[model samples]
Target: MKKRAAFLIGTGCVLIAVSASLAVNNQLESLKAEKSAELLTEAFISRTTVFETSVTEMTNEPVPEIIADNEIRGADEQASAKKPIIIDGQEFIGLLSIPSLGVSLPVNNDISYPLLKMTPCRYFGSVDSDSLIIAAHNYNSHFGKIGMLKPGDRVNFTNAGGLIETYAIAEVLTLPGDAVDEMIKPEGWALTLFTCTYSGTERITVRCVKEERI
Candidate 1:
């Protein structure tokens, strides 16, 4: 009986140590994500400012009538272009903001294991196409609390070209991690944000639709 008690105490100590170590590691990851987010936000803002300045100067210059007409014709195409914003040697597509969650993070142009560690990445589709899907790790500084969002919550995405698209949450549901086809299927959702559940077995999916501007 005494030997069994000692063994039980030893196992308890091991479990406690493992739990503490995991907590520390999680905290460190969150800190890293926060720093990366700050850097990306600054870069995005700088790029937008420069683009706006150039546009202002161009508009100020006198233009030929025919040239002005051509520019007007291509305006829609230019606005829909997904220009890559490079920061720290990584290509970011734009900034994603969830006002209800008070979360804003730069989304990379492509999704991968390494990139997800730094910030959210575009899992599929484009913002202009109205089928954007984003994925990120469940770090507290990332999409950890997205599951708390409700229908009608506001989410915004600012593209590299300085256009901001607003979306309203339409639904929140869980999908199996292997449901890749369903996750990317437009299905009338203008935007979809997803993160792994706390157990890492399923995805917490937030479906959003474009919010009509008054």
Candidate 2:
């Protein structure tokens, strides 16, 4: 009967392990859903006043180029004329919407673990400047489905100042993670958002250009 008792104990342990794993998975999904809801509410409803205040405060500050390494690059006289509005308490630039992909997420000015888990990040450039490069983790709700975007798809960038810039997708390409310098360079005014592939071997880049301002 000793062997029989051991088998029953082993079965109990296996059942306990499976239950714990299932609980953890449910919690993670709940957290993801909660975070997405928070972003949608913040992007569409709240934070409008906060963004306007941020714009006023940063209106005179220099528009520093934020490179891949977060270094301030050479000055663009034209860009410097506009203010860099990402303030201490108010780091979010605005909401980025790709209707085709059903992506409507808040955009933080800086890339960090806490910020990325909550929303996409503006790694470099700005809405009013030459190029804007945003990044996100390859979650299904984030930039994971960006590969499905085709040329001519519309991408909307809504700034804190209540201004919306509509962009037309121009190209979707993949590049090595080491190509930070090349990625930040703008051929002209454009918007770029990237996420790593599932294997993390390369970055999938979606490039868009301003088609209209509203």
* Poorest stretch of ten by lDDT in candidate 1: 54-63
Off by over 4 Å in 1: 50-81
Per-candidate Cα RMSD to the true structure, in Å, reads 6.8, 9.8
Q: How many residue pairs clash in each candidate?
A: 0, 0
- Per-residue accuracy of model 2 over 52-122 as CA lDDT, tens digit each: 32222122232222211112323452233233234334466676778787767767777887667767888
| Whole-model Cα lDDT of every candidate shown, in order | 0.78, 0.68
TM-score of each: 0.84, 0.66
* Candidate that would win on TM-score: 1
Give lDDT for model 2.
0.68
In candidate 1, list every pair of residues with a backbone clash: none
Q: Candidate 2: where is the Cα deviation over 4 Å?
A: 1-37, 49-90
Model 1 residue 101 distance off true place after TM-score fit, in angstroms: 1.2
Residue 75 shift from truth in candidate 1, angstroms: 3.9
